[model samples]
Target: MSDTETLNKLRGVISKLARELNTTATSEGLTPTQASVLGLIVFRGPLGLTELAQLEGLNPTMLSRVIGKLTELGLIQRDPNPADLRAIQVESTEAGRELSDRIKHHRTEAIAACLDQLPETTAQTIINALPALEALAQALRSTHN
Candidate 1:
């Protein structure tokens, strides 16, 4: 098979693997939207609801509902932006941070178990290619933007 075909097949496998991984990771703690919102807060820093809605491709009312649920759960909080009284910045709580860490740990353990099943060389190949793949992804992101 050609390298392009092999990579495409690998990408498909990775997509399925990611979905499987997220199923368990997201089951008990939060709904998918909540988890994604929490993840964005954790990694991307606090964002106003408008910004978050844009990032998540959600309508304002829908984003409001999601934020309401998260706020009610005490996993997220919003503070008025100093420069924009109408805009509220959402941030994760300490509890949310703890939950995010736990999710990370659990996913890591699961991935490690799966990787252990692979041949040593196959595993090494993936590790070695990660940087190259990430660079490619960055270039793609820039192009898309």
Candidate 2:
């Protein structure tokens, strides 16, 4: 395939994978964005609203809405930031952590099952490309920042 064709194919595959993951997240009563927010909180520890907004590439208002929904669902809590009493800190609740873990487990299982169907050499090639893939992601993120 030409470079353009190859890029298009890669994009299509990635988009499909994202759709599948979104479907899985939706089944667990979370949108992709909500799941992502919970996962970030779980992994990064508590963060102030502004900080989380920056990290999530979201505006304060939108992030606030998302946080509100998550809070109502009991997946996250907004607490007063100790260092900055005026600012609020967001953290994943125990329920949020459990749901995040379950979502991750489902995603891993789904991917592993898909990879299992692929020929060993093909799967190994994809594994070997992980670093390049990560670099590509970082480069894209840098451009946005």
Estimate the Cα RMSD of every predicted model relative to the unseen true structure.
Answer: 2.6, 2.0
For all candidates in order, the CA lDDT equals 0.80, 0.90
Q: Write down the worst ten-residue block by lDDT for model 1.
A: 23-32
TM-score of each: 0.83, 0.90
Candidate 1 lDDT, 1-145, residue by residue in tens? 4699898997898789768778754665677677777778877778888788877778988888889988898878899987798878989998877777777777788888878999999989988988988897787667755
Best-performing candidate as measured by TM-score? 2
Stretches > 4 Å off in candidate 1? 1-11
> What is the per-residue lDDT of model 2 for residues 22-100, given as tens digits with 9 covering 90 to 100?
7778889988988888899999999898878888888878888889999999999989999999989999999999999
Q: After TM-score superposition, what is the CA distance of residue 61 in candidate 1 from its true location, in Å? A: 3.7
